[model samples]
Target: MSDMANNDLEKYAKALDNAIMKYHGLKMEEVNDTMRHLWNKTYQGTDIDGIKIRSDVEGGASKRSYNYRVVMTKDQVEMDMRGRCSAGQKMLASIIIRLALSDSFGQNCGILALDEPTNALDVENIDALAESLVDIINERKNHSNFQLIIITHDENFLRKLGQAEVMEYYWRVSRDSRQKSVIERQRFR
Candidate 1:
């Protein structure tokens, strides 16, 4: 009876591992595809060719954890992005990963909200983010429930994003004299 139980437990573990591997493959494909699309549009002349997600298993057979790292391919050489990339690059990668995760798992929700997405991004990267967002918007325009909500204090970034979306007006929220929140619709210049 003990041997039978051990065999069953091993089978269960193998099944669970296989399932995890399958999910990991799907996630990797989604992330890579998203990066390919966004990176090309964001970085025009940069030597960074693309990025790949590397996963490693840690701990013993009974207890395992997966560690993922973003590796950049430049000049046909691969480099890990941890502690080696600039702040803007890291921010861009973070945004891309979020976008990929949303794309893979949030299809039913149909909404993506970004708060202070331009933080740590340079002027050029800000514009690139706007363009990438516009591309995403266009891709999801056919979905009736898809909506994007962006909250930021940077009016310049908002203007750039509005231009990308071809919007004429945006809602501005501010505190009134009595310290109450007021929402107003303002035309984008």
Candidate 2:
């Protein structure tokens, strides 16, 4: 399966945003600003906060290649540097989803399934990610609708989240070729 399907981007991003806001006690506007800043710095000119995004790709038979240009806020952000630029776009998509969720259904939503949220993030970004997740849980505490199942191999990262009160359950999974993955749940005290 894809790292993240396009359809699910909005949902995931919203969850992420809510998590961040809840943990930090930040306003929705602050979350948006932070997300936009991260996206701009990482993509180096890409404007994900803008209203629309447009892309174009070019290639040939002898040599396969592409030229991607994203137009947002009436500004043209072009990437002709080297490799596939889709990765950056995907990251941006993830951020966008988080922002959208926090802006809309943050109060009503209860559960979130996050698969390797820090896969492409740097050290700083990872720290930010942790803070964001914690914030979401805290913000939704009164509603008690927030539950998170985060799948990752990063022990340290998991530890950070485990510190939160809302993280009530933990599960470990082991897989063998002959059998399906087995899940063991550990209740947090």
For TM-score, the strongest prediction is 1
Q: What TM-score quantifies how close candidate 1 is to the native fold? A: 0.83
Off by over 4 Å in 1: 1-13, 44-47, 165-168, 187-189
* Model 2 lowest lDDT segment of ten: 46-55
Evaluate model 2: give its lDDT: 0.57
Candidate 1 per-residue lDDT, tens place, 1-189, comes to 999999999999999988987998888788788877777787543857877677888986568788989998888898998887777787788888788778877889888888888888888888888888888888888888898888898778888877774566789999999999999999876
Each model's lDDT comes to: 0.82, 0.57
* Each prediction's TM-score versus the true structure: 0.83, 0.50
lDDT per residue for candidate 2 within 1-189, as digits (tens), equals 464676487678778766864654445345445555444443333333342222233453334344433334324453432244345455544654564455444657666777887676656556656767677667666776666667888777777777765678789898878789988997766
Residue 161, model 2: lDDT of 75
Off by over 4 Å in 2: 1-89, 92-96, 102-107, 164-166, 176-180, 187-189
lDDT winner among the candidates? 1
